[model samples]
Target: MRWFLTVLGVLFGITVFLFLDYALPSRQTVRITNTYNRLTDIGANAIFYASADAGTVQNAAGQRDVRFIDTVRPNGRPYVYRNEDTGWIWPPYFKYDSSNLHAQATDRKSTSANPEWVSVTSYGWRVSWLSIYPNAISIRSVAGPDVRPFNWPAVLILLVLGVLLFMLWRMWNQFHERSIEPAIRSADEAWDRIDAQADAARDRARGRVSRWWDWVRGR
Candidate 1:
């Protein structure tokens, strides 16, 4: 019985561990990305505008054939838009591309570096972008931190099982204790009754022997 209890306890512990490790989302991460490209010949002086009903932007790469990469968001919504007429293209996901633009190119040796023309705005779940034409904007995905919520049902079940096991252990102990007590009491009672019977028999024998001796002497 002791060994059985020990085994049951061990199994319960293992079950709890497995449920938490695999069944529960102890750690989670999310990232979201959005990309846009300019279709019109809006010169460097003019700003390019692109709107997405829902999403986010990370970083932009390349001036013309730009590529954007980002993590998926927790909410899991990302959108992409492209201008069909200008040959401008924006991928819904991460990809590489190479294309030429009529706009001024930023030179590696130039003193006045071209501004990192990237803009990010968050309006609830929607993201928008604006930039000069002949250009493409790549918005990387967003990344979210890991999180884990406690599993109440599993916890409750474990608790209940633990309580039941404890109760069984207590009951077993009580039963053994009670069983021994009754057996011991019965043995003691039987010994007492036997002793009483032996004493009565001895007294009766002495009385008969004494009476017989007196009769013979008197005769």
Candidate 2:
């Protein structure tokens, strides 16, 4: 029974550790969308500078525009960019310059227009994937599915409770085992002593009886 409790305690500890490991990584992924936005903002600023001379535009800082365009993957699933700053506000046919502005799949490939100006914005969107990762060639957007935060406080509480319970059980077991040990030893010793005394008394009685018989018989 003691061994069984010890084994159970160990299994509980292992389960807690595994849960923490799995949960922590997923929490990190939740922050990925935010991180990607920061990268996109940086990329957008860079494109703004590269697109035209800073002096050419009036109210350059205030008029700066950023939008995210919703696009479907090849699998026909909808994934809108989390950053509203980079989405497409207009249809694909709207021309940025002389060329029509079509929704291009966000990939690493360089999609440029006939005129370099049109390509400037499109290329900026395309190369924005590079900002996500320094050496990444492909822009694979994560499925913006619902994600839950790792309930760290709850986990911590559970761990603490489990540890306390395990310790209490262990201490109780030890105390009970120790409590009975001395009583068991004392009882065994007392029984042995009693048996010895009974044997001695029986032997003495038999001798006395024999002596009495001899005296009586006068043989």
Candidate 3:
């Protein structure tokens, strides 16, 4: 049972990690190569992309013009990202700044020869098999690709999770000390008192029986 519980805990932790990794924004230092939009019908992969703009209709077509940012990493590999407003659900970015971000990405476009580095803040994975790209949250020009952004979001998430776990631990300890342990101790004491009463009653009955036997033998 202990091993089973340990395995279950490990799986839960992994699931949480993957969910956060896909949901939280991370920084990527790359050079903007292009910016464009395309109209495509979202089928099964609709979940990978952000939802339709707020107050928009939903239908079987699932068709929308998705803005994209094309970038190349420092190692000259291409990275594509989708710029979309997350609306009021899902990842909860609450970001509705696709137009401004697209303009920024287009303005910062650089060629391989000049290679202007920029930090692209995004969340989600670029899984080719899944036909999904990370959603770019924001971007800014940087001096070079060697500079890495500090992951404040991850730090904050960890801090909040840590505090929650600590509180839970404290609550469990207090429950044992104040409730469970005391209840068990009271039960044990009650049982001991009951056993003493039974023994005393038996002794009194035996004394009465001996007195009756002695009077019969004397008469």
Candidate 4:
């Protein structure tokens, strides 16, 4: 039971960590290479894209026009981002300015000879297999590709989660010590008393049998 609980806790912790890592906002400093719009099929990766009901533009036949911004990191690794309004759905960005962000990205576009650094704030993961791109929340010009903005929201959320887990651990320990252990000990004592009574009754039955055998031999 202890091993089972330990495994369960580890699995739960990993799931929560993954969920937060995906949902929390993160920033990447990169050079804006180009911006364009594409007619995409959300298809199997619909969950990664915005919901039709909560998006500014509804998808027809699981297809929509998604705005994309191409970028390159300082190390020259390419990254692509999707610009869309989250509307009133999950993550609560309440972003309704996809067109503005697209315009901003287009304006910031630069070439390899002269790079314009910009910080893009967004959430979600880019899984190439699923053809999913991170949805850009906002973007702004940065001093350089090395600039990294402090993530205060993510830090505070982690701290609060830590505190809550600690409290839950304390409560579990208290309940086990005060209730479970005492009940277990009482059950053991009761079983021992019952065993003692059973042994005495067996001994009495044997003595009665011996007396009847002695009477039959004397007759």
Q: Which candidate number maximizes TM-score?
A: 4
Candidate 4 lDDT, 6-42, residue by residue in tens = 9999999899888988988888999999899998886
User: What C-alpha lDDT values do all the predictions have?
Assistant: 0.39, 0.38, 0.88, 0.88
lDDT of 2 by residue, 181-219 (tens): 778888999999999999999999999999999999996
The residue pairs in collision within model 4 are none
lDDT of 4: 0.88
Point out where model 2 deviates above 4 Å: 1-154, 173-178, 206-219
Model 1: lDDT equals 0.39
The TM-score obtained by model 4 is 0.80
TM-score, model 3 to reference: 0.78
TM-scores, all candidates, are: 0.23, 0.27, 0.78, 0.80
Off by over 4 Å in 1: 1-145, 184-219
Among all windows of 10 consecutive residues in model 4, the one with the lowest summed lDDT is 53-62
* lDDT (Cα, tens digit) per residue for candidate 3, span 25-112: 7999999999999875677988888765543334567776788999999987899999888878888888888899999999999898
